[model samples]
Target: MTAVVDSAKRHTLQALLSLPSGIVRRLAGRPVEIEGNILDPEMQLVLTLRKIEGAAIEERPIPGGRRALVDAAKAVGGDLPIGAVTDLDIDGPGGPLRLRFYTPRNLAAVSPALFFIHGGGFIYGDLESHDAMCRFLAERAGVRVVAVNYRLAPESPFPAAVDDVEAAYSFVTANATGLGIDPDRIAVGGDSAGGNLAAVLAQRATRAQVGAPPVFQLLIYPAVDFAVKRPSRTTFATGFFLNKRFTDLTEASYPPAGVDLTDPLLSPIYGDLTGLPPTYVVTAGFDPLRDEGDDYAEKLRQAGVAVQHVREPGLIHSFANMVGVGRSGPEAMGRAAAALRRAVSTP
Candidate 1:
């Protein structure tokens, strides 16, 4: 019976997958020019439309980047749940970092919490880009989620974003009681660059003696290694939402220009994963980051860390963020929520 239900659910989700892409293409046309390794204005416009459409449930302009896209989201997405949204300001190693909290509705006392990081290859994106996904996680998993708005690269380089993530984790663990959360049930999670941060936090938590250890680490299409050559990089480099040139631009924007690409914290697949927390790592079939995510999972398993790796065939790198726009978005959320529940329910 459970298998039947699951199959039906997947079929239903697959049927709805084309809606978001169509919506994005119609709203924003293709790019006219490509400049400085970044997508042309027209392509950026299309990307913005896709982002807004995917995050349409509770769209708002984040701290930086395009504003017109934000306005369009506001007009279409409608009001998100009140209790599910709140702003947070906390002191970090650099200074102050901002966060957005998404609390699940009708949850029990001392619910599990997820420290979520949004994806943008360490360059673009903010809380607004991931609002819908966060809400879906919170409500579906019955977990409180705090999405950190770590400083983007170029403005703040290596270790800066990592520092903010660490600070946010520290603050949350320290104030868990006040926030009505179980410190023991805290998990760290993210996609793309944010996924890299989550992986780093898992290592940091194991090394440092501060606060509760992460109950789980959830990485979705994580950019795990900067050096190791992967087949996906060459095969799926172009036409995908994330391309090699843009990825190079993003990496170049980081501070301490020419930072070793093999650094473990920056590219965690190269890091020691022996003592990291249990992990759930998801990868996309068509994403350039696919091999890295797979390698990270294999490394974790070899290191004896409990790891469950899911490779979503036919999916793209940013599919997790496309729930509002893509037909499979909601289904992806459901899978993630299930994983979070499993991780949280474990000792």
Candidate 2:
């Protein structure tokens, strides 16, 4: 890794360690208040607190309040050489969606393509926030990467983002010839809420009978369900980077009101996983959503979908995003990139 990246990782880890444990714990176990104004005073306070913490951690806000906290993570090791970046905007269900394409310099043609979705729950995050990581993946996996800028919540709502994702996928598949990509070598992947969307998209594509389904899915500490409770929800719900309070706030920001939490489209863990693509699920040891990710993977397995689950010990939720900060951050990304490469290389 580059010296700059090494510094970033160190900075990120220090900031995370400095977070008030009590506040993290309280934030984790906080319950969602689905009544009255969506932006209730308490909700606003929680948002404010989150912003404060984010600022302390050097988090950068994307178009929405969706912030990517790893941008400022001090790199702790040598930087890995990367490649070229090209930006484009594709038509979506609502309008046009922004996309960033990354290709390493020495990569070969007919390489696998990874459609990346960034995590910020459903509220914040964009292509810029995850720029380095996407480039890292393209370089490390020796594949092309297309990172989607899906719509955010509180405005776009549940299905809106999902619709945009599907539209983006369709556009990519339909225009694969022009893009010089192999339609049969496509995979979808994401972290946190993005992971949830990746899972949902696999199901959506299979059900809709769209072009060939994605060959594999890479889910990193994904938030898969909003209805059924998991053990992590209680054990690691409080103190950590992602807390219960933030989850509730983000959930509120998405649906606003009157949306069924159990809707398969909303909470994909409750959705049918049958006939979906093969999957690789990554979970954090101390994350509240760990069990949900595990459960979702198991559901896919039981439904006959090929699946593999990897649990990172001593890691917390959202750690992968900290690639610019903690030692484990880039390590996780490297592992994920290798996994994607293996998935794409397999016949």
Candidate 3:
């Protein structure tokens, strides 16, 4: 029954993707250009489809929100093929941690790996929501991927997610041989809130906290600082998919009431940027969080860290999970995967 459902889902996705670009553009209507940045047409098409569903952030409950996100990811990504997947239980700061390891076909005996974290504003997502992304990166970048199911907020708020990821990093580096990864070549990365955690973990690594530092860091439209309000926040606040209302909900819940937003744990932009590993920072030109991600990349450069920044003007946040749709999202993500492959591969 599960297989049949999965097959049907993939078939639908293929049908959607097989539509001609001319027809997609026709359905998407006029392009959305904000501040000289044009939105990706394929992305616009998805937005058009979403407009029909018309679900508002205020009406979304946590459990339902989580299920919806996972379902949407599966619909688009559909458990893309991979050589191997191994589910492992590791010691976390809070009891046992669940991790899914991905290995691509024809990989080396031991290869570089990515410690991937999923994004959900620190309140929702888990390993299931990002399974397709993990498979995409592992298969495309030719690296092993370990996707962590870290603790979420409102249940284990503030530093709980941080503690678990830090502990997981230590375990991965210590047991590198057993996990079929090269310890020295491990990288850390994530999308959105997960990207925030990755940045925080990299900073801790500089302080000799999370084993050896990650060789590279990939942050996709990461939420770096919650303290300041950039113009983009208001400019693209509504109708761009990730709106201010939803962000407000996440902010209200992730940190305990009366907690400081500027604290480095919640916002890594306020922390010292020295001694960090090489990094690739991605920002969506139409995203509300654009300015902050751009700012973080500049700070990394000034701190003397090797940094690569890409602003996909036509793209929006969550492009990392957009493999099943139009050309632009996959094109943007492919560039990141290429960068990851370079970062992990032996010189």
- TM-scores for every candidate against the unseen true structure: 0.79, 0.79, 0.95
Candidate 3 TM-score to native: 0.95
lDDT of each: 0.72, 0.71, 0.85
Cα lDDT tens digits, model 3, 29-147, are 89788778777777787777666654643357887877767766666666578999989998888899998899999999999999998998888788888888888899899999998
For model 1, give the RMSD to the true fold.
9.3
Please give, for residues 1-347, the per-residue lDDT of candidate 2 as tens digits.
Answer: 45465465455444643356555345434433321212122222223335554343313333423322433322222244567788888777888888888878787665778888888777767776677667777887888988899988767888888888887888888877577678888899888989988888877777875555888898999888887777777766664567777776776677657878888778888888888887889887767898899888888899999898887755667666554433456777788888888998854
Ranking by TM-score: 3, 2, 1
Q: What TM-score does model 2 achieve against the real structure?
A: 0.79
Among these predictions, the greatest TM-score belongs to 3
Error of 1 at 31 (Å): 23
For lDDT, the strongest prediction is 3
Which pairs clash in model 3?
A: none
Looking at model 1, report the run of 10 residues with the lowest lDDT sum: 33-42
What's the ranking of the predictions by lDDT, best on top?
A: 3, 1, 2
